[model samples]
Target chain A: MMHALILPLLFPLFAGAALLLGHRLPLPAKRGFSLLATLALVPVALWLLLLAGDGQLRLYAMGDWQPPFGIVLLLDRLSALLLLLNAVLASFAMLYACRGDDERGPNFHALFQFQLLGINGAFLTGDLFNLFVFFEILLISSYTLLLHGQGPARVRSGIHYVVLNLLGSALFLVGVSLLYGLLGTLNMADLAVRVAEMDAGSAPLVAAAGYLLLIVFGLKAAILPLHFWLPRAYAAATAPVAALFAIMTKVGLYAILRVFTLIYGSEAGPLANMVSDWLWPLALVTLAVGVFGALASRGLQTTIGHLVVVSVGTLLAGLALGSQAGLAAALYYLLHTTLVSGGLFLLADLIARQRGALGALLVSAPALRQPLLLGLVFFAGAISVVGLPPFSGFFGKLMLLQAVPPGPDALLFWPVLLVGGLGMLIALSRTGSLIFWRAEGEPVAERADGLRLLAAVGLLLGSVLLVLLARPIIAYLQATAAQLLDLQPYLAIIRGGEA
Target chain B: MEAVLAVTLGVMVTCGVYLILRARVFPVVVGLTLISYAVNLFIFSMGRLATGAPAVIGKSASHVDPLPQALVLTAIVIGFAMTAFVVVLALRGLGELKTDHVDGQEPRE
Candidate 1:
C-alpha cells in the first residue's frame, strides 16, 4: 500500500493537528502528548527504512492529481534515511526539552511538531514550490522557537536571524520562479527532463538560473561568505533550538544534491561544474573562519556554533568535488556532522546549565558531573570534524581523496585540507580546555536532568556506530549516488503515472 | 534595454550591501528588504524576457513563461511575510530596549 511512504509525513501532520488542541490541555499533558507523538514517528521511520532497503520507491500525489500540475511526495532511499534521522533527532530533542524542571509550554510543543512537519515535508516533497511552502513552515516555527524565551539579547539576535533567513527565503522564491519560467513545470522530474533538452540559445539562461538556485541553497547551507548570520544566531538560541538547527544545513545539502542530481546532472548543463568549482575555495575559507571563530569564543555554546560551521564547510568541500566517490564521502560526512554537532550542542547546553546560564557559562567555568564525558565527546567530535581516524570521518576523507583524479591541481587541495584539520584541532583544544579543564574557579552545582545527557550520549554513540557501520553506509551512499546519476528511473516515475 | 534594468538591480544590490554593513538595526532591516527586491528582479530577469505576453497558457498562442511568474508571486508573498516578521522584531526591540543598535547593550570582553 506504500503506507510506509506516507507515514513519516502523516505522523507529524496529524500530531500537529492534535497539538492545536494541546493548548487546552495541562502543561504536563502537553509535554507528554508532544513527546509521545514524536516517539510515534520512530516505528514508521524504521519501516520506511526497511522499504528503502528493498528497492521500493513511493510517490504520493495530492488529491489524485497528476504530476507537472500538483504537489508530490517522493520516497527514495536517501529521503527515507534522512526522514528517519529527522524524526529520531527531533524525538530525542523533544525528550530533552520536555524533561522536568524545564518543561516547555503548549505553544512550544505545537510549534515543534509543526516544525517537524515542515522539515519532513521539505525532505519528501518532489515539487519545488511545495518545498518552498514547507521551508516557510519550518522557518516560521524556528523563528518562534528562537525567540520563545524572553530576553533582550535573544530577542535582538532573533530579529537579525529572522531578517537574514527571510532574505534567503526571498531569494529562494526568486530562484524557483526563474526555474519555473525556463521550464513549464515546477515538478522536479519534469524539470529534469526539460533541462536536459535545452539548446545553446537557452543555455546561458539555464546556467544563470542554476547558479542563482545554488546561491539560495548555499546561503541556507551556511557555505562560506554567506555564513555571517549563523554563529551569532546559533549562539543565542536555546540549547534544544540550537540542537534542532544542527541538522538544518543537512536540508540545504539535501536540496543541492537532489536538484543537481535529479534535474541538472553533469550532462544536462555546465552549471553543476561551475558550482562545484566555485565552492571549493569558499568552503576552505568557511572552514578557516569557523575554526578561528570557535577559537575566539569564550563560551561553550558559541564555540560549538563555530564548530558546526566548520563541519558544514568541510561537507561543502566534499560536495564540490562532484564525483560519485566524493558524494559518497559527503553523504557519510553529512550524517556524521549532524550527529556530532547535535551531540555537542546538547553538551554545550548541559555545560551552560552547570554555569547557570549561557552568559554565565561564558563567564564562569562549569563543573560537570561527568567531566570526562565532555572531554570524550569533544575528542570524538573533534576527531570526526578534523577527519582523523578510527572514526568515520577519516574513512570518508580517505574515500574522497581516492576519488580525486590525478589532475595537475590535485596537490593544491592538500594544503586547505591540512589547514582545516589543524584549525579544527586548535578550536577543539581551546574550547575543550576552557570549558572542561581550566575553569575551576566557579562553584559546582547540581547538573540538569539525565535525559539531556542521554540525548547527547545517544547522538555520540550513534556516530561511533556509524564508524563501525561504515561498510554498509558506504554501500548505501554509493547506491544512492548511482541512483542520482541515472535520472531515467526518476523520469519514468513522475512521467509514467504508475502508482 | 533589459540590460539597464539589470544594472539598476545591481546598483540596488550595492546599496543593500552598504546598508547591511551598517551598525544600526533599522538600516539592516531596510538593507534586507532592498536585497530581497533585487533578488526578486534578478530571478524574474532569468526567464529571458518576452514581449507583452501574459503568463497564462492558451491553446494556440505562445505565453511568456508562467513558471517564473508563479515563482515570483510566491517569493513576493514570502518576502512580505519575512519583512513583516522582521519589522515586528525590530519594533519589539524598540519597545523593549529602547535602542536600535546591532549589538545588544550587554558588553562582551
Candidate 2:
C-alpha cells in the first residue's frame, strides 16, 4: 500500500504519455481513457487520505535509495488532503472539458493529464528540486492549455504568462542552488534540519535564498505585487482550463505552507517565522486590491479572476496568523474557494455561450436560455463567495475570523475582510442584475449543454457538501494542520532512512 | 577567478534585465535567453567552480559536486524548451495582433 504514494504521480504520467502517443485515436476513445485515468485518482487520493489520517509519515524512496541522496515522496495528512483536492477539481474540469471543449484544440486531454501529473508531483515530493521539476511540468502543460483555442487575447496574455514564469523559474533555481551550495542537500527534510543547525555565517545567504523562493512562490500564488498577470491570463484561458487553474494558485500557497513551516519554521534559530510579518500586510493589500478590481472589472471571467485573488488574500490572512487554528481554517477555506470559484468560471462560460454576441461582458444582454436554473446557481455561488450564510464560504470565513486572537492584527483583518466581502457582494449583485434581469433582447433559443451544467453544478454542490460535512472535514484539516506544524516526523525521514 | 566569474554573471544579468524590459518581443526573448545563461553559470559555480575535477566519484580524491551539474542540465533543457515556445508564441502574437509590441499595439507617440 505504500506504493500508493507514487500512484498519484504515475497514473497521470502514464495516462498523459499514452494520450499523447495515441493522438490518432478517435475522440471518444481519448476522452474515455483520460476520464478513466482522472476518475481513478479520486479513489487513490481518498485512500491516501485515509492512510495519512493515521498520523504516520510515509516515505517512498525512489529506487530503494535512502533519503538525502535519492528523491523521495513524503505523504502526510496535508499532502494527502491536497492530492484529494487536486483529484476532485481535476475530475470535474476533465468532465467539463469532455463536453466539446477538448475538440477546440489538439491534445487537450493529454495536456490536462500532464498538468495533473505536475500538480500531484508538486504536492507529494519531499525534495525541493523535485518540486521545481513538477512546477515546470505543470507550467509547460498550462502554457499550451492556455493557448488551446488560439486567439489574439490568449496569445497576448500567454506572452506575459510565459515570460514572467520563465523569470520565476530562473529565480527558483537560484534559490535552490544557493541552498544546495550551503547545505549540500536538496531533500526538504534534510534542508529543514540543517537550516535549524546552521552557523550564523551562512544565515544571511540562507535568508536571501529563502526570500528568493518566496518571490518565486508569490509569483505563482499571485500575491498582490506579483499578481498583475493572473486576471488577464486566467480570464483569457478557456473555461475548463480556467476552472482547473483555481487549484494552481493554491499550489503556491501549499509550497509556502510546506517550505516555511517545515524548513524555516519556529525551530530554526534567527529565521523563525520569516514570512509571517511580510504575509500580514501583503495579504491585506491583496484583499483590498482584489475587491476593487472585482468591482471595477467589465467582464464576468475577469471579475471572477479578481475574486480568485480575493480568495488568495483571505487564505493568506489565515496563513499569516501563524496558528494551528489559522492553518486549519485556511485549509478549509482553501477547499471551498477552489471549488466555488471553479464553478463560477464554468457557469460564466455557459452563460456567455447562450448570450451570443454579448459574451460575458458586464453589459445588459439577452436573457440566458435557462435563466431560473442558471440564476439560482449564480446566486448561490455569489452568496457563498461573498461569505454569506448557509454555505461553506461563511463558515470558512467565520472560522478564520474566530481563529484570530483579538489584537492589532485582528483590528486590521476584520475590517478588510468584511469590507472586501461587502464589495464583492456589490460587484456580484450588479453583475447578476445586468446579466440576469436587465435584458435588452429575447432569450437565446439554444439551451445550456447538459454535461456542462452537470460539471459546473457538481462543483458548486461541493461547497454545499462542505457545509454539511463541515465537522468531519474540519477535524481532518485540523489534524492535517497539526501534522504540518509538528515537523519532527518529517525530519525523522532523513535520519531513519539512513539506518 | 571568482571575481571574474562574478563580474561576468553580473553583466549578463544586467543586460538580460534591460532586454527583458524592452517593449519588443525579440529583445525580450533574447533577454530571457541571456538570463537563463547567467542562471546556468550561477548554478554551475555554486558547486564551487572546480576545474578538471571529475563529476563522477572514484575518479579522483575530491571530485566536484555532481548535484548542481545535474540541476543545471535540467534547467538548460527546460529553458531551451521555454525559449522555443515563447518565440513561437511571439510570432503568433505578431501575426494575429499585427504588432510586435507586447501590449498587442504600439503606444501613441
Candidate 3:
C-alpha cells in the first residue's frame, strides 16, 4: 500500500517520457498513448486518496535510503488531494489542447505531461532541495511550452516569465543552502524537528532563509509586488495554456501552506511569533493589492489573472490567521480558488469567441443581439467568480471570513473581505459589460470546439459538487491541520525516535 | 570578520541592483550572476565560517558539517544552469523584440 504513494510521482514522469518517445509517431497513435497514460492516472490517484482516508500516511525512501539520509516522497491526505487535483487538471488541459492547431497541439501535450510531473513531484517530495528541483522542471518545461507555437507577443512575455522564475529558483537555492548549513539537513520533516531545537541566537539567519524561501513561493503564487510576469503571460497564452497556468499558481500557494504548517507553528514561542507577526500584515497588504489589480483590469484575461492573485491573497490571509480553523479554511479556499480560477479562465476564452463569432454570424440579423446559450454560460461564470451564494466560491469565502480573527484595532475581517468581494464584482461587471452586454465587435471567429466546451462545463459542474461536498472536505482539512500542529508525527516520520 | 563580509554583501547588492536596473538584458544577467555569487558567500558564512575542515570525514573522526557544502555544490551547478537559461532567454528576447530590456516590450530605443 505504501508503494501507492510513489505512483502519482512516478506515473507522470513515466508518462512524459513515453510521450517524448512517441512524439514522432502517427498523430492518432500519439494522442491515444497520451490520453491512455493520463487516463491511467485517475484510478491510481483515486487509490492513493483511498489509502490516505485510512489514516495511513506513506513515506517512500528514495533508493531505499533511510529518511534524513536520502530523499523521501511523502503522501499524506493533503499531498494526495493536491496530487490528484494536479493530475486531473493536467489531463483535462491536455484534452482541451487537442483542439489546438496541429502546429501547437502535439508539442503542447508533451509539455503538459512534463508540467504534471513537476507539479506532482513538487507536491510529493519530502526534501526542500528536491522541491526546488521539481520547481525547476515545472518552470523550464512551462517556459518552452509558453513560447512554442505562439506569436511574437507570447515569445516576448515568455522572457519575463523565464527571468522571474529563474531568479526565484536561484533565491530558492540560496535559501536551501543556508537552511542546510543551519540545520544540517535538507529533509523537510527532519529540518522541522531539528529547527525546533536550534539556538535562539541563530534566529536571524533562519529568518533570512525563511524569508528567501517565502519570496520564492510568493513569486510563483503571484502575490503582490512579485506578480508582474503573470498577467501578460496568462493573457498571451492560448486558451488551454491559460487554463493550465491558472492551476500552476495554486501549486505555489500549496507550497507556502505546506511549508509553513510543516516547519513552524504559531504557538511555538518567539520564532513562531515572529513569523506570524510579519505574515499577517504582509498578507493584508497582498490582499489589498490583489483586489486593486483585479479592479484595474480592462480585459477578461487580466481580470482572471488578478483573480488568481486575489485567491492567493485570501489563502495567505487565512494562513496568517494562525489558527486551526484558519488553516482548514485556507485549505478549503485553496480547493475552491483552484476550481473557480480555472473555470473563469476557460470562460474568458468562451466569451472572447462568443462576442467575436456572434458578431460575425448575426451580422445581418440585428434583432438577435447575444448568442443565447453562450451568454447564459458566461452569466453563470460571472456570478460564480463574484462569489455569489450556491457557488463554490461563496462557501470558501464564507469559511475564510469565519476563520479569520478580528484585528487588534477593530473587529475587521469582514470589511476587508467585503472590499475584496466588491473588487471581484467590479472586475467581473466590467468584463461582462464589455464582452456580453455590449454590442459585439468584429467576430473573433475563434470559438472553442466541442471538447473545450465539454471540459469547461465539466469543470464548472465539478466545482459545484465541491461546494455540495464541503462537509467531508472540511473534516479532512481539520484533520490535516491537527496533524500539522501536532508535529510529533512529522518528527517521528523523519527520526524514527518516537516510534 | 563580520564587517568585511557585510561590506562585500552590500557592494554585491549595490552592483547587482545597478546592473539589473540597466536597460540591457546582459547586464541584468550579469547582475544576477554577481548577486548569486554574493548570496553563495553569505550563505556559506552563515554556517559560521569555520575553516580547515572538510565536509566529509575520511574514515576518521574529523567531520565538518557536510550538508551545507553539499547543498552549496549543487546550488552552484543549478545557478550555472539558471544563468545559462536566462542568457538564452535574453538572446531570444533580443532577437524577437530587437532590444535587450528584460521587461521585453518596453518602448524601443
Best DockQ goes to which candidate? 2
Q: Over the stretch A97-122, how does candidate 3's per-residue lDDT look in tens digits?
A: 66653347456566777787788888
Instruction: Give candidate 1's total backbone clashes.
Output: 1
**Where in model 3 is the C-alpha error above 4 Å?**
A266-269, A354-370, A406-410, A441-447, A497-499, B1-14, B39-56, B59-66, B106-109
lDDT of 1: 0.75
Model 2, residue A342: distance off in Å is 0.6
In candidate 2, the residue pairs with backbone N, CA or C atoms under 3 Å apart (3 or more residues apart, or in different chains) clash, namely none
Per model, the share of native interface contacts recovered reads 0.59, 0.84, 0.55
Q: Ten consecutive residues with minimal summed lDDT in candidate 3 chain B?
A: B59-68
Runs off by more than 4 Å, candidate 1: A1-3, A100-106, A269-272, A357-370, A373-381, A407-409, A494-499, B1-77, B103-109
Tens digit of per-residue lDDT, candidate 1, span A394-485: 77667766766677435766666677678778767766676677665554667556787888778767678888887888898888766666
TM-score-based ranking, best first?
2, 3, 1
True-contact fraction in model 3 equals 0.55
Docking class of 1: acceptable
Query: Candidate 2: lDDT over CA atoms?
Result: 0.94
- Which lDDT tens digits does candidate 2 get at residues A97-138? 998999999999999999999999999999999999999999
Clashes of each: 1, 0, 2
Check candidate 1 and list the clashing pairs.
A181-B68
Worst 10 residues of 3 chain A by lDDT: A359-368
How high is the CA lDDT of each candidate model?
0.75, 0.94, 0.74
Query: By summed lDDT, which 10 consecutive residues of candidate 2 chain B come out lowest?
Result: B59-68
Off by over 4 Å in 2: none
